[model samples]
Target: MNAEQAAFLLAHALPPEARKDCWQRKFTRAHRSDLKRLGVTDTQAERLARILPAIAYYGTHGPSLAAARTPLVILAADAHKAAAALRVVLEGRDEAMQESRGRLLQAIESLHPERCEVDPARASFFHSYDHREPEALRLLTALQDVEQAAQHAVGCMPKAQTRAVAHTYPVELIDAALSLDGPAFHVSASAESKFRRVAALCYVAAGHGEPLRAIRAYLRERNASPEN
Candidate 1:
């Protein structure tokens, strides 16, 4: 489907009653539980919460995508990568010069969710040795390794502060990774208080111009310092 249609579908999927204006506002409290059932971790759930709504909106909105299994699986794979990239940024560098390349590439692979399903038919076109399930498991194992590496860094921050940083920082890293930006851009920029990188991209990809006008104002408000 075209980007405009996808954007409309995404915007429509969002519940009207939610308070936040971030990409994740599309979901309700119940939606959070839905994510857990899908095997998203407690830490990753909040980030996936932003991506799943778009997938759901498109999954049912388009005929070609809705009738097939492949698109959803592909989306599941991408969402997993985006989620993993965000998780990696949560790995504190402590003023290090750059993010690890090996780690970032692993970010894309490691996002295989624990609960992801693999049908035998979809698993292989040739033989048992070529099965997709094993490949998926290998990726999940990689993701776990990154999480373990980040654990010590996480210990350096308070719980509440980590959660706050997570809301914006991780999302930035996900966008940077996808955009193929340079290593200098890979590090998280905590000074940017707002989170328009992903949200704006979603809208732009949707080809919807209406939201851009309002989004500009919303950004200004977010960019403003609290004391001012």
Candidate 2:
């Protein structure tokens, strides 16, 4: 079947409520016989044959499909990376950057409600920790790591009081990562936040100055209780 025929058949298979003008545009001049051969039933085939032309005509002058898919593509890529990082933390595997691994895992787990459920496996990890100084240090280190990841994901808008410098990527991209659904959105939020914290820490460590002071001040003020 031709592209038009395939488009029509696909549209018909979708729910009636989903039959938007866009679908009609993509399926113009679709053939009934072609649709049936492609597995659409007679009833579905007939419906599509009627609506396809109008949809195609409207879409021809409407937004390009590429425009709709661009954000999706970006979000998908970001999510894949985040998921891979989360898997490492969940398995207790050594991540490339040890300091940020725990924080990364925490932020990721925070995004899901499943973490709050009483899973035996998760409980085992918490209980297994020995109450020793070394273990305590390790836990603290992990928390720090996760915090850094969260900050990076949010994207540091430079502030004056802290020395932490924000990453140079577009703020909109960070916002998109936080707001978009799917894996990339989650991953970007985690990774971006972690990266930002790391940058801030490095600047302080090198004695270059606190780059994120302004950002920290802003967060602090925002979280403060309002005056009566």
- In terms of TM-score, the best-performing candidate is 2
Tell how far residue 54 is off in model 2, in angstroms: 19
RMSD of each: 24.7, 26.9
At residue 187, candidate 1 shows an lDDT of 21
lDDT of 1 by residue, 30-113 (tens): 544554453334544343345443433322222342234444445555656755764554444654413453344344445643
Candidate 2 structure lDDT: 0.39
Error of 2 at 142 (Å): 23
What digit string (tens of lDDT, one per residue) describes model 2 on residues 1-228? 233443544444334543564444322233334433434445443443344333223213333445544554555455556555544554464565554656654554466435334444445645663222233344455655555555454344332233323322212222222222222211122324542333233233222333344344434443563831
As a TM-score, model 1 comes out at 0.18
lDDT over C-alpha atoms for residue 48 of model 1: 37
